[model samples]
Target: MAGLFGSATLGIGGGTLSDLFRAQYRGKAVAIYSWSPILAPLVGAVLGGFISQNTTWRWTFYASSLLSIVIQLSGLIFLEVTYPPLLLRRKKARQAKATGADDLYTEYDHLDEGRVQVLSTNLFRPFKLLATQPIIQILALYNAYFYGNIYILYANYIDLWTNVYGEFIEIAGLNYIAIAIGSSIAAECCTLINYAIFRKLSSRNGGTGVPEFRVPIMLPATLFFK
Candidate 1:
């Protein structure tokens, strides 16, 4: 009933970006971090098309399973605990255990709530926000429209290339390279533009930081989407 796997994946990714990058570089770090997951599927589309054309489709599943296994093992072995609150809780528990103290605890230990409460809040948050905030509703609708068009393109791409353009399946997959290139360019451009705006805002605020600096970057993005 619950998506534990998806939750863990997002937690690890978001935690990694927060723990690994400085505040000034965080925007770029987040941009690059977000790019990988989307790029992987685009890359897979290109590879899958070629593989299915030349070899058995079974090989695609085989390769995917192998990659997933490797990533899982690597995560289990190599990933460090990046969440500060979790780390502090573990440290406090170790110290308390060593000292035989019942009262010693980390701040996070006291903030705990029932799992059901947490799940319910997270589940309802999107709907609540969409209902309450017109801006969020508009943004959600725009993103849904954009991604829906992308899915439509993915569905029809093979037919367009193979039937309309008279290209082979393997050759048709190369068309995805254009999408990949455009994504990379757009991501880099946005990263640079966002950082530039953030720097100016930070300067105008006498080097004090606020999240409002990030909102202007959306103007360019909205224009691009138009």
Candidate 2:
């Protein structure tokens, strides 16, 4: 149940991040965010193995708890709301105070009624999109398959390393380095390709890039993932 709750929380976190971050920054941010999901188990295994070998298995839980506390403290200190609507609300309140005018305007203030309707629509929009939108349905199916393959690979990685390669626990954990290496290489390649493509498309489109410019890059990425 705890694991289920944690997964649910993570899904919410990812969705919130996607909602908050602009498309320009989201790719890099998501790539970095994704490293935690990939690295956590490998790090835990390494720490557990060291603790169990040097002292006791119980120390691993203590160490992880301490690290979690430190991370939570850091988040409390540094993280701030970056949503445009929230930021604009804060700005408007400050402006209203300074000018003594209650009629301060913000994009969010105009949407109070519409926002409620939009929220209601969003709640059921995913199912509607899947039923009506071919692009949405296809992309959803592709992403599901990709994520399923990734999970299967993760689940079998240790077996592949230990049984096939004859690695010890620590050595098996070290094999996660291959995942890190592949991720790093892919990141660099994608960054270069995306920048080049964006520049070309922007120039061709009279110096402005649209979301459509991103579509061409997705084909290669999908092919690579497959």
Candidate 3:
């Protein structure tokens, strides 16, 4: 339960940071952030093996805790809210100072409904939409299948490396680097192709791009995943 909570918190915080970055910088941020899940476990297992060999297994938890503390301190010193509503509030204040308006405020400061009711509606709407929306249902089903395949691959990969290839722990860990590299290359290629397609479609459509123009790119990705 504690580990699950920590993972959720990290995911939320990382998402918040990504939202703070501009669109131009977001691709690089997301790429680096996505790399952590693949790299961390492999690096952790290598370190854990060495640590347990030399000292004790308990030190692993202690080392992780210390690292978390350092990260927390750094965040406290540097991190700030990047949500548009909050930034708009600050911007409004500055504009008020420059123009000396007494009634300066952002749209976020005014709510037509109560906050508690809004929160409750927002939380439940996703469930309602998922229940009724065909597109959402189909996508959810597809995502479940994709995740299941990934988990199965993760579970069986070690056996394939150790038994089939006769590799040791470090060598098996190195195999994951190939998966990471392949994924990175695939993502880069897809991004470039997407940009090209978007450009061509925009030119064809009188320099205007529509969301439907992007749907064709998903076909290739779906085929690759299959």
Tell me each candidate's TM-score: 0.80, 0.71, 0.69
Off by over 4 Å in 2: 1-70, 113-122
Give the per-residue Cα lDDT of candidate 3 at 166. Answer: 82
Among these predictions, the greatest lDDT belongs to 1
What local lDDT score does residue 49 receive in model 3, on the 0 to 100 scale?
48
Cα lDDT tens digits, model 3, 5-58, are 566656575768557775334445555556565556555655654565567879
Model 1, position 57: C-alpha lDDT score: 95
- Candidate 2 pairs with clashing backbones: none
Q: Compared with the true structure, what per-residue lDDT tens digits does model 2 show for residues 1-226?
A: 6365457546766776777776555556665666666667656665665676577778877888788789779978997766677778889889989999997788677655577798888778877989999999888898789878976876677777678888775667667677766866676667567757766887898877786776788887888787
Top-TM-score candidate index? 1
- The TM-score of candidate 2 is 0.71
Q: Which pairs clash inside model 1?
A: none
Each model's C-alpha lDDT? 0.80, 0.72, 0.70
Error (Å) of candidate 3 at residue 191 is: 1.8
lDDT of 1 by residue, 173-225 (tens): 88888887888888878877888888889989998758778789787677777
For candidate 2, which ten residues in a row score worst on lDDT? 1-10
Q: How much does candidate 1 score in TM-score?
A: 0.80
